[model samples]
Target: MKAPYIFNIQKFSVHDGPGIRTTIFFKGCPIRCLWCHNPESQKYNQEVMLTSEGEEEIVGQHYTIEQIVKKVQSDQIFYDQSGGGVTFSGGEVMTQPIDYIVELASRIKRLGISLMIDTCGVAPVENYQKILPYADGFLYDLKFINSQDHFKYVGKDNSLVKDNLKFISDNGGAIYLRLILLKGINDSMDTMEKTVEWLKENNIKISEIDLLPYHDFGRDKYNRLGRKCTQNFEVPDEQHVLNIKYYLQQEGYNVKIGG
Candidate 1:
């Protein structure tokens, strides 16, 4: 009754969170960001992917909370060793049935394992409120500050996003703000300053700011779907990131590359 339209399950991912983790990538997103690396995750329905052998539909066996716990517990040895547990990524994790997210997160918390959610913060505050108690930390993504820029590039105005971030921060949500460094899109000093200003205005002390470099991983998928790929924008080199970091540091904010 509470099944989510899930797409992929990745095991042993280190880059997503602390130590080793199993990331559950759910399906469906409200905003279609041009630079999304996982374009396959944009749809709510299960999609078919071609493999060497044949076609593969992404729908798999659904696991209940207890069932999923077994798989997560199997990684307990790793969890104990690396301080990693599970991360709920998505199309948008909060976009799923709140009951499902709450049930799953509550179970994981009961296990004393660290649970994290990587969100675009486009969903309702009630959704965030439901999962906030269970989350040990949040990987909060902020793409653009200007409403029009956000609408053009990300396909949605960010007023709700801003409110959600403020809501979470005001309620004492432990968060690491994630900003993707796109060459011509969000890398300008004006955009960066606006982002910094938003953070400052919220009185949110950044635990860390992860500057993600845009890549072209989703180009082939877009091609396969018969859709024109648009996120092939240039990426900032290491030096460029360094300059941005210097600017953030000068503003009294600590910055880092990659979350």
Candidate 2:
């Protein structure tokens, strides 16, 4: 199989999964979320971005499965110590070829390493099915419950995302639902209620709901990539995050403020 484009391999990433993890950031994403922080990761092919010094710099490179697995294996000692593993993050790791992901995941599993796919859940059901056998679990994003709101903010309809989530649930896939709580974007009480309703209606049992507070940390990346930073949403305050967490707990759902 051809190698997949990758933008980054972040080591010692604590927030990507259970323990200290190595995050493999794949390139390309179908949905153009307005609040996306990794603008350099949105494209599949190699691209150039401006550096802080105002010099052009390349952003992506292709990596073979063997090469990636070897790199991840170097961190085996850490994984064994902390229950950490490798997290395939994005530009939607699902956008890569399913066969490639399956192969890489197989290798990781063979090495006794846990594998987690951080996805936007906007891919086809078959993609999920093909990857399910290899992945230990998923760090799935749930941006919006209402389709229109999702379209308005994410530049795509929520149908595929919702359907894929339901599919995962039906298949008894382990899921950690991540909701980016952006003030005035997707943090409305109504949205939260709808999400709770949908989960109950579908009988989806997630490990936990991680409420990621929206921040402008990626704003500089947009500028560096020469992309327009159109995000105008404010980051939710600490109290707001706590309130949402409390509300979700009240609804009988396990919730955490951050990953």
Candidate 3:
């Protein structure tokens, strides 16, 4: 199998999963969101990005399962203490070759460390099937409850997203549902209502609901990468974000302000 290009192996990452984990960021994504923070990671190949000092820095590198496993093992003590482990994130890590992910995840779990898969949910369900056994949990993003809005901003049909999520849930995979709150975009009481209704209609069991307020941290990165940045998005109000949390909480869902 071809080795995957990982842009970064983020260590001590507390938000990606339960414990302090080394979140392996794979390079390449199929869908482009209007508010993507890591715009430089949208490509599959090793590429260049202009640094703060105006230098060209390569963005990706090849890594084998052994290399990543070793890196995760270095933090084994921390994982043992904090219940954190390894998270496979990406330019949609699920879009990478299935065999490679399966092997990588299998090897990582052999160390008795937990494994989390952060996905945009735009991939073949076969890929999820291949890795489900090894993945301890999934950080599944619910960008929009409606398919129309999903394609309007994300530029991809959300059918596959819902299908893959349903597949995982039916298979009894633990899931942490992540909701991206954009002020004038998807943050609304009506949207949240549809979200709850859909989850019930589909019988999708989510372990937790995480309300993520949109931030412009990646706007400069887009400029650095020489790409057009969408400037119309706004962060949801702090009180509104809390309101969303409370709303979901009222629906009998365990909701948190952030991931």
Tell me the tens digit of each residue's lDDT in model 3 across 218-249.
67888788888874588899999998888899
How would the candidate models be sorted by lDDT, starting from the highest? 3, 2, 1
For the record, the alpha-carbon RMSD of candidate 3 to the native fold, in angstroms, is 0.9
- Candidate 3 residue 105 Cα shift, in angstroms, is 0.3
* Candidate 2 TM-score, true structure as reference: 0.97
TM-score of 3: 0.98
Give candidate 3 regions above 4 Å deviation.
Answer: none
Query: How many angstroms is residue 63 displaced in model 2 relative to the true structure, after the best TM-score fit?
Result: 1.1
Weakest ten-residue segment in model 3 by summed lDDT: 223-232
Write down the lDDT of every candidate, Cα atoms only.
0.83, 0.89, 0.90
Q: Write the per-residue lDDT of candidate 2 for residues 1-259, one digit (tens) a residue.
A: 8777888999999999889899999999988888888888888889998888999989888888888988999999999899999999989888788888888998899999999989999888898998888777899998988899888888999889988988988897899999999897788788888899998998888988999999877788888877789777888888878988999999987888778
The ten-residue window of minimal lDDT in model 2 covers 223-232
In candidate 1, what are the lDDT values of residues 1-259, reduced to their tens digit?
A: 5788767778798877788898888888998998887787888776666443455545433567776777787887897799898999988999888998899898888888889899998999999999999997789988888789889988889998889888888888888888888897789888888888878887876677878888777677765655677775887878888888889989987677887
Model 2 residue runs over 4 Å out of place are none
Q: How big is the positional error of residue 83 in model 3, measured in Å on the Cα after superposition?
A: 1.2
Residue pairs in candidate 3 whose N, alpha carbon or C atoms collide under 3 angstroms: 19-84
